[model samples]
Target: MGLSAFQMVYWKACHLPVEMKHKALWALKFLNFDPHETQTKRRNQLLELEEMQLHAYDSSRSYKEKVKLYHDRKLVKIVFNLRQQVLLFNSRLKLFPRKLKSKWLGPFGIKRVFPNGAVELENPNDDGQQQSWVVNGERLKHYLGGEVERFSKVMMLVDP
Candidate 1:
């Protein structure tokens, strides 16, 4: 008995050599093309592809959400109030290679609080001039050190 069209296609996919060219006319006469069955198979394949795509999207979204949650849990909320003393972290000092010196710059006072973790700092100098600058709040830590008392006394001696 001659092979059917379904068997011929299956044999070709499996790398089996079938002599179809010699019996090409006979194969065409026996070829049964059911349009309804072909359409049903195509629809099933499309549905499977859509389902796989949906699964991939769901997996990626869930992974992103898990990553976000992990990072959020590690976040430390730093709050600064006006006139509060804090030390500014000096990131540039690492390049100079000074191990003994402190990396934190100043016992700067908070002048203004801006939105999104930004704070304006008042310069630590005891001079009359007060300089202020804006910096990220993450680089600052609370200052708990002692306060220095400035003496304005001036004594003069005269010969009697």
Candidate 2:
């Protein structure tokens, strides 16, 4: 009978009857057992599992970086220089506004440019009072005021 190291140790620890103790020791002597081989196999398996986890993490990180680059490319680059006149978007205006109301608020002049995309705007009506505000570049656009033809409503006389 072949006995493993653990089985042999367990038999030794337990107080077996006198007749069975000799037979158990004799069986253990003929068995081929290597504890170091079992330990090395377990260590190798753990190392392989760790390598697989690292590879999965790297692949996920690279995919996220690619998506970020794609989104960053779609963003519009609108930069304004100092003293440039730009119209501010009236975001506060509601969907149902007054009939003759315009969506844009200003032809505000850019007073200064911050390191970020924010610009300090100055009112054109220089009333000796310096009232300026910093706003994001996305809220402003270049003012294009030109001779636009206005369309007037014409009533037609129809006989029923």
Candidate 3:
């Protein structure tokens, strides 16, 4: 039993963070994938997915296929949204919302500012964000502390 299709999905699902787990947990609802199948079967399903012509994959029986087909077709624009949301859970900045506010509120004076500090706002692209960008504040470096290589207490943005 190398790996059942559902098992493979289960394995991946196990590694998935909360959002993806939610998506994978009830995967059968939105997508036609079985999170508890064998790998060989899953691989076969992926082959069938190749025939769906990307856009039409939603009509397929496996959500896994839709994801794979979308990847195969380079239809990043369509599949990225949900996948990106799932990926966000795995980001290091999971503490912050999709958007954030930054300030030199730390005790440090000012050394140098990171690229993100310069933009008004930039998307962290937590996951599959195709157009990830960041929003930064101007003159943020002026408030940095000299000994501070990094500061965790900077102003952060949160989703309402």
lDDT top scorer = 1
lDDT scores in order: 0.72, 0.70, 0.40
Model 3, 1-160: lDDT tens per residue? 6776777776742333877777666866667655566567988888878866675665665878778888889733222111112111112354554454332222222222244433322233336332322323332233222432233322333222
Clashes of 2: 0
Model 1, 2-67: lDDT tens per residue? Answer: 777766877643323455553664665578656588799999999999999999999999999999
TM-score of 3: 0.14
**Model 2, runs deviating above 4 Å:** 1-38, 89-104, 124-128, 146-160
Which regions of candidate 1 deviate over 4 angstroms?
A: 1-36, 124-127, 146-160
Q: Between 1 and 2, whose lDDT is larger?
A: 1
Q: Is candidate 2 or candidate 3 better by lDDT?
A: 2
lDDT of 2 at 152: 21
What's the number of clashes in each of the models?
0, 0, 33
Candidate 2 local lDDT, 100-158, one digit each (tens): 66666666679998988888877633345655777787888887774322212111101
Candidate 2, position 89, lDDT: 67
